[model samples]
Target: MNLTGGIVLYAVLWFLTLFILLPIGLVSQEEAGEVVPGTHAGAPHRADLGRKMLWSTVISAVLWGGCAWLILGGVFTREDVMNWDQLVR
Candidate 1:
């Protein structure tokens, strides 16, 4: 992938990882019996955004590195995936 493509890929991966990790070990206000006035009970009691971001970055970097290795190393080229039908036939 080109520079822009690589950046876009990493960004997408990072956000996806963040979303997946968002709910893990979460403490909702309702769950903790600490719902504040005018706020939804489902709201997080305390969002550890910094730690989640750090973990997301680390995990995304590893995932991006593996993908980059596969792509840059030509382990699975476009033609390889494109020829799936032919191979099956």
Candidate 2:
């Protein structure tokens, strides 16, 4: 792929990743049922869930960036057609 093609692919992948993750990241764990309404902050599970969500968001961002880099670097490519014969030839 050419440089422009790579950049386009990267942008597409980055946007897709952000689109999928932003909603979940924006919501708090308390709202997601990680913590019961009456639960105290001292509860381990409550705190753990919040931490997990944070880490998940960070990891997802890093992964998305890496995928964009790979796409732009031509390390990955999309198939032109889905049919088996088209792919074989």
Candidate 3:
């Protein structure tokens, strides 16, 4: 993959990881019994975004490294995906 493709892949992975990690271990305001004024009870009591972001970066890096290796090592190619329907025929 080119530089742009690699960057895009990492960005996608990062966001996906972040979203997946967002809900884990979260305590809703209702559960915590401290719903802030005008905020929904379902809102997080402590989002802890900084920690999640750090974990996201680390997870994305490992995932991206594996994907980059596969792409660069010729384990698969774009043509394989584009022509995937034919393989099932």
Best by lDDT: 3
Error at 21, model 1, angstroms? 0.2
| 1-89 per-residue lDDT for model 1 (tens digits) | 89998999999999999999999999999999999999999999998999999999999999999999999999999898899889768
Please write out the lDDT profile of model 2 over residues 1-89, one tens digit for every residue.
56785567556655665555445435455455576568653343333444555555566667767766776566665642235467667
**TM-score of each model, paired residue for residue:** 0.89, 0.36, 0.91
lDDT of each: 0.95, 0.57, 0.97
lDDT score of residue 73 within candidate 2: 67
By lDDT, the better pick of 2 and 3 is: 3
Q: Candidate 1 deviates by what RMSD?
A: 1.6
The clash count for each model shown is 0, 0, 0
Better model by TM-score: candidate 1 vs candidate 3: 3
Tell me, by TM-score, which candidate is best.
3
